[model samples]
Target: MTTGTIREIDSASVDADGMLSRTMRILGCFTADEPELSASRLGALTGLSSSTLHRILAQMLDLGLLSRTPGRRYAVGVRLWELGELSPLALRLRETALPYMTRLYEATGENVHLAVLDAPAPERATALYVGRLTGRGSIPTLSRMGGRQPLHTTGVGKALLAMQSGDWIDRFLAQPLERETMYSITEPDAIRMEIDRARARGYATTREEMTLGNVSVAAPVGSIAGLPPAALGVVTRIDGADTRRLGALVTQTAADLGRALRAL
Candidate 1:
């Protein structure tokens, strides 16, 4: 949305429901870049009156929905973990697939991961990445287990892009791609070419496109029981990298994981 329109909506929600507005604002404080927030930062973020923010935070803390950090910063709590653990989909799938992903990591000696496009859910732009593993001296990466990444940039991100319908692909490309790193692809045409390559080869690769000096390969693991296809993959350094060979490994790993998902 336009900056003005988003600002207006943010102001309008304040009048909608005092409690609900504060709750969403609290959650909004955590960004893709920042997973933790101090109460003062949250206050500045939501622009809610401090009294209201404090009360809401207190309630969330008492309920275990939020956890208090060393200096009163708030982070998603173990209660989220407890509640999420109750969801059979998240719990069972991650538990089932971790061993296989671990094996992939041990064998390839690269960061292994699993993720899916949010085709089934429209209200949120989400990627359900089940795992992320990094080794000592591995290239620094921002992706995390169960964390979300933009669909335009990362290896897992491009895998999501490749599975899109032609219309969806067109619409996605019609927008601007953000420049996260000097190596990231900011042009729509380049992303389109990469997506085409991913489609042809059954895997995706990025060379510092998401993070500098880090190269990653991702392969699609198609869905089971109507779920979106998942991306299972690995990440490594660009030095001495053979991207095509890495792509081959990712494709094989993704296929094996897809079979495991279907069997479960």
Candidate 2:
């Protein structure tokens, strides 16, 4: 319950030892890790009677907070996502950067991405918007807007990761690094060495590490001192791309974005 608010009689929350309580308990099972649930598993986890859970589920169904998956289990709803889009920072960034990203796309005809750190869990930075060139077919990019990618084997991910601390770095390498492609880096020591290099160089690269026949150049963008909003990168086809040229361009764009973010 929110503090300092007057308690109302018959509030939406009440003693849940019965059907209503059990239903709310079941609904609470959904997390970012556990985005969906079977009614039986939910009932057991929540210690709700099967009959009560079925009834409470009907209420959630009415509210559109949960929907049936292909496997016929309940999961988070699109409506909840719609609400998150209303967040001020999220809505403002997209509006401000859309034109610039579009202009970059038009000029380069490559894949452009916008990313932001999950401030609370900075290790798992987020990709917010990915812009693809409309006219030309770019190299197949592994990154998608609104999807999560790794900070080790990806251009933007490593760039985003480079801005963080040694503690965060150590935690990241603790996991078995995923191999997106044969070129992906897996050795923890090597990745740490590269992160140090990236911090000094101010950019990162993925040469078919995330996808075959694809390569990318990435740089940090408009990151706050303690928090990086995102790393912006352009992914292009591998052939005929000059490493110096791509790195310079990405670094300049990132600097421009960093300045813009500071103003905001």
Candidate 3:
């Protein structure tokens, strides 16, 4: 393993023999960009020795926590997905929000997105996409159901960020903002301005910040007692798109969904 990987391993493996920690560390090696990895690659990335790595991999594979691909690479298994679907975020939130999201898509025929904050702490949070709807004519997006994105770059992310307290925002912004595109707002003050505008207008917008040639408008669903903070968004080609109109529609849809959730 590389020296950097060794150092990371040392730092993370304080409970070196803890099965839960080791399993989680192994799972963390998978990502959207690299969904599948060979045993050797897993050993290198996780800094687990070959023997230990193989042992864990064998157990995970047997338990259906992982699946082997045709090329002898491992991917997250359907069993994990089965477990995720049972979470309240999936059962209660997404199930309640889908009808409103479907109506929004029918109204605009655009890409509709639903995302939730992954952690209560702003500094550690990311926007986790839970549901998505898109038509053939809709502009493509990098976001996928079950994927995670930075809280500063996407419309749904910004909408969720706008709901946070000033101190929470400050703590979140203290971290280095990722620049997904040249147009992405990385400066803290500028992002704060965006958040202010979003709070005042009841929605947020991103102009080719996450992806080129696309713009998004979104609004938060407000907080529900049993649910993580969530938001709704629509993405479309920037050309001839009216952000204000879309913003209004998104804000209303998010509100409707929030009320529905509360009544349940």
Candidate 4:
């Protein structure tokens, strides 16, 4: 057996082995900006010794969780990507929302997004972006596929939040909320009112809340039976766009996507 295989066997023999956690930490070291790294760099980032890091990396390589690049740096392997594609919440939502998102982008010439709520936490709530479609002249945003954003400041986030129970909303509001931009709502009562409005209107909107000069309108991608699995939104420049009309379009698109998901 190869050294990596031997190490894997040895690690598995030990009860309550920390190898899994260390391996996860190594994988977590990579990001959108830093997709690849040398073993030494990974060791620095993860605080793992060279010998232990290399051994775990070798096992990961053997398992196809990571691959070595031409420069001997490592990156997440195609197997990881393949596994991510199998996720029901992220991949299924992306597949179901893509056609409608594209249609919304084409019709409005704006940036379209589909996001799902992260599991509820005591400290905060977040939205995980699953898919996006950028229009020809759409304003730039910090969001990326698989990236996360705070639930309070984003349109999709607010739409998803509006579907939560009142007690859950209160708990979320009790957490520390960052003011992302000048217009971001920081007061708990203000956000509570906003959530009430969104729940009442069947859609949500934010004007320069998450980012300056950007406005977004969104609706939940499911019914009020429970918290939505996803939300659909469009982002545009605040100055020239008719936000009310765009809001109507996004609400309709979200309803259509919701219906499609239900049929599945």
Highest TM-score scorer: 3
- Per-residue CA lDDT of model 2 for 212-239, tens digit only, reads 8877788887555433367778788888
Q: Give the residue spans of candidate 1 off by over 4 A.
A: 1-18, 32-36, 87-89, 119-128
Residue 207 shift from truth in candidate 4, angstroms? 1.0
Better of 1 and 2 by TM-score: 1
Off by over 4 Å in 3: 1-16
Clashing pairs in 1: none
Regarding TM-score, does 1 or 4 come out ahead? 4
Q: Which residue pairs show backbone clashes in model 2? A: 16-21, 115-230, 116-229
- Tens-digit lDDT string for candidate 1 (1-264): 011112224535476655664575577666546668887898888887889889998998898878978775788877866886755446656666687788777877877877767543232344556567768756667877656677767788788777777777776666666788887887878888989999998988888777788888887777676466567778888899888787777787777877877887
Residue 56 lDDT in model 2?
Answer: 78
Model 4: pairs clashing at backbone N, Cα or C within 3 Å: none
lDDT assessment of candidate 2: 0.67
TM agreement with the true structure for every prediction = 0.83, 0.71, 0.91, 0.89
lDDT of 3 by residue, 50-141 (tens): 88889999999998889999899999987877887898888999999989999999999999999988754567788889899999999999
TM-score of model number 2: 0.71
Model 1's TM-score against the true structure: 0.83
lDDT to native, each model: 0.72, 0.67, 0.88, 0.82
lDDT of 4 at 237: 92
Error of 4 at 109 (Å): 1.1
Q: Which residue runs of candidate 4 sit more than 4 Å off their true CA positions?
A: 1-15, 120-122, 223-228
How displaced is residue 59 in candidate 1, in Å?
1.4
